[model samples]
Target: MSEQALSRDRVIRTLPLTHWNQPHHDSGALASLEQGNVLFLPHLSFTLMPEELKLLDPALVAPKRKNITFDPQHNRVRGLARQQYAQQVTDLLSRYYQHCLQLIDALLPEYRHAVHSPSNTLRLHPVSTWRSKSSWRKDDSRLHVDAFPSRPIHGERILRIFNNINPHGENREWRVGEPFPVLAQRFMPHLSGYSPLSSWFQQRIGMTKSLRSRYDHMMLQLHDAMKADRKYQEQGPQVTLSLPPGSSWICFADQTPHAAMSGQFMLEQTFLLPVSAMLNPQNSPLAVLEKLMQQPLL
Candidate 1:
């Protein structure tokens, strides 16, 4: 398809926030968390043809690894589907990126430069746990910002698009962790030892008296909080979005804390396509097309 033909705005403008529970704007919510402003688009359903699903089946997608776990704090079952879906996923994401860029261009024409970057892309984390259930634990998981220090804030946004390929009337919920910014701030001082600053300070001035004292105080508070709050340990914000086959949800990765639990029906599967830093100022369609026109596509 021609580049121009690919440029149609795809955002659902009527509902400012796609998901029911999301804040009207993510900036204010993120500020409450002591994080930078963020934009959240939810309940975004992408129309994927049956042929596409068939193309992504185990035979074509291939399995990369098995019994791999993602939770660092606790052990969870995980497996890599395979790199076979790499090219297919890239093509799909490229199209989705174009759709997103068109929407951005329409919404903030002046900030068009921001959308001119190649979308940072990665294949799905293969079906991590095919058919397994594990109890959630605090050491199992905790809330934190998605991006690291080095990554540019502009492209740091994450796209978590979920495609539910289940029969009609399947009851399922995506339990999101709570946004405890106050708790995060109170706990930050204690996490300092795990921070980059601690390493630098240790190298420069060995174990200083003041530093040790500060660390001790922070750890004590953190320990106390964990022990005191049973609800904080056992209870979390778990909401189920009953998505039938062909429906999807595209959400801001950092804004929402998420974990999944299987439904009553034993047979279940979900396709997740996560894209990071791909639609920023550098590698977007506008930028790439400009370069291609300068030196025609041979």
Candidate 2:
């Protein structure tokens, strides 16, 4: 795309806050989410206590650790130094995770019962000073949808809440691309068919946490293809999003094509919502691809 065209597309790509302020069971908010539009909460924030504020320092981050991860399933926090403040960090993240859940329940009430707890993660990270010597697949700078190589979600929707806590009032830059169905149409023909033998063998050898379904296979391939394509990375249909300090946004990461450009002091929570619980299940990435391919994905 030309500079002028890209600049014109830079308009904020988010659902209005009025939708979020609607009733807890509002269908407008749910429909917006189901359509893969981000719900931008500019006034929403995770208030940090005095002690919790210390965790935002870039020095607290461990070497080679991209983010401080809190796994509720294991009740542990990783990627942070200063064991003395581990409990505080855990508490802060736990509270943030719960905050995200409350918002999700309020905005997307239908997903309350379908949210998977064990698969969720609360993460805090600094983007400004972090650097990784990684390949394209691991690079968040490249626009791509969410897909886990080790954990196959069996077509579950990946819902995520992100809060920018930058103390210096910097913006968390991100570029979001075209719709999920548009991306699938561009790359589906290039992806290989799923092999049952390979899926079973990988699960048996513990290479994967669970059996990889056809849906998972296609998603991983599409994820890689989007990142691998240089032309698409530079000229794809997308818009830039600048999330300011104290701003929080929620979206389906698996359905939204996104790339984190730059920022610092970010708190993120991931939640898995079952496809069956969606307000419009057919609008999900799984269903979109299944319809395009004319076959059952799982």
lDDT of 2 at 252: 91
Task: For residues 166-229, write the lDDT of model 1, one tens digit per residue.
Answer: 4344533433443323334434444423344663465457543333323232333343444344
Indicate which candidate wins on TM-score.
2
- Give the worst 10-residue stretch by lDDT in candidate 1: 4-13
* Native-to-model Cα distance after best TM-score fit, residue 178 in candidate 1, in Å: 3.3
Tens digits of per-residue lDDT, candidate 2, 1-298, equal 4233443223233444333234454477678777777777787766788777777776666777767788876778888767887898888887877776677666766777888853333334544344255577888888899998989999999998888887788899988787787789999878888899999999999999999999999999999999999999898888878899878888899998888888878888888888989888999999999999999999
Q: Which stretches of candidate 1 lie over 4 Å from their true place?
A: 1-44, 59-89, 103-112, 115-172, 194-233, 236-250, 262-298
Candidate 1 lDDT score at position 87: 49
Task: List lDDT for all candidates, in order.
Answer: 0.34, 0.78
Best by lDDT: 2
